[model samples]
Target: MTTYHVQIKVMPLKDLLDPQGKAVLGGLHNLGLNGISDVRIGKHITLQIEAESELSAKTKAEEACKKLLANPVMEFYEIEMVQG
Candidate 1:
């Protein structure tokens, strides 16, 4: 098995309500950061995975995201894999 590094980004669906993101944006605006807009808060997950091939590593990461890391109903995830 080869060691791989995985990056998972999980975020709220565009149509769903993101109170945390909105709160952050409001705070930023209050702080006088006017140029920032459409601010969305999300999770950035990094992990090490062992698999037989690059494809397998990606599959494992994506599966983890679907099954445990991300909420399918209200959120979406993107995965990036790289060999360490």
Candidate 2:
């Protein structure tokens, strides 16, 4: 088995409201940071996975996201296998 680095991005669905994002946007506006029309907050996750190959590492990371890291009803996830 090889140790691989995986990065996962979890974000809210586009159609759903992101309260934390909205709050940050409001703060930005209050700070006079204009021209930025939108803000969407999300999660960045990094995992060290032990697997036989990059594909296997990615698959394991995907399963982790689907099972525990992300909420399918409200959030979506993207997985990237960096290096082994």
Candidate 3:
């Protein structure tokens, strides 16, 4: 088995309201950064997995995101994998 490094990013759905993100955007505006209109806050997770191949490691990472790392109803996730 090979160890793989994975980065999972979880973000609020486009149509969903993100209070934290909104707060940040407001804060940015207050700081005189009006050029930036929107800000979306999200989570970045890094993890290691052991699998037989790159594909399997990626598949496991995807499964982890869909099942536990992200909320399917309100959030979406993107995964990036690398060799460790």
Candidate 4:
């Protein structure tokens, strides 16, 4: 088995409500940081896994994201795996 690095980014669907993101966006305006519009917050997860090859590592990462890292109903995720 080879060690792999996995990164998962989970983001809300376009139609989902992101209160935390909205709040942050509002605060940006208060801090005089304009031109930043449409703020949305999600989750960033990084981990190490053991797999046979790049394809195996990617498949495992994707499974992990779908099973626990992201909510299919409201969120989507992008997965990246690199040799470690």
Candidate 5:
């Protein structure tokens, strides 16, 4: 088995309301920066995994995101794997 570093980014779907992002956008405008638009906030999770190959590591990381790191009903996630 090889140790792999996994990164998972969880974010709301486009149609979902992002209150924190909206708040940030509002604050940016308040600070006189109105050019930025459609700001969004997301969660970044990083962990280490043990797998037989890169493919297996990726698969396991994706499964972890789907099962525990993200809420499919309200959020989507992207996963990245690297040698650890």
Candidate 6:
């Protein structure tokens, strides 16, 4: 098996309101950062997976996101296999 690096990004659904994002936006505004109109907060997950191939590593990472890393009802996730 080969060790692969996987990255997962989890974010709130576009259609849903993100209170944390809004709060950050408000804070930014308070700081006089007016040029930025929006802010969204999300999660970045990195995993070192042992698999036979890159595809296998990616598949495992995706499954991890679907099963536990992300909440399907409120969040969406993107997975990528990174070369290290």
- How far residue 74's Cα lies from its native spot in candidate 6, in Å, is 0.3
Over 1-84, each residue of candidate 3 has an lDDT whose tens digit, in order, gives 889999889999999999999999999988898788668998999999999999999999989998899999999999998656
Q: Can you write out model 5's per-residue Cα lDDT over 1-84, one digit (the tens) per residue?
A: 989888888999889999999999999999999689999998999999888998988998888887788998889998877555
Tens digits of per-residue lDDT for model 2 on 1-84? 899998899999999999999999999999999998779999999989989888888888988998899999999999987854
Root-mean-square deviation (CA) per prediction = 0.9, 0.9, 1.1, 1.1, 1.3, 0.8
Candidate 1 regions with alpha-carbon error over 4 angstroms = none
- lDDT of candidate 4 over 20-79, digit per residue (tens): 999999999999999999999999999998888889888888888878888899999988
Give stretches of model 5 more than 4 Å off.
none
Better of 1 and 6 by TM-score: 6
TM-score, candidate number 3:
0.91
Which regions of candidate 2 deviate over 4 angstroms?
Answer: none
Top TM-score hit? 6
Question: lDDT at 69 for candidate 2?
Answer: 97
Pairs that collide, model 2:
none
Clashes per candidate (backbone, < 3 Å): 0, 0, 0, 0, 0, 0
Model 3: lDDT to the true structure: 0.91
Q: Could you tell me the lDDT of residue 84 within candidate 5?
A: 58
Worst lDDT run of 10 residues, candidate 4, spans 75-84
Each prediction's TM-score versus the true structure:
0.93, 0.94, 0.91, 0.92, 0.89, 0.95
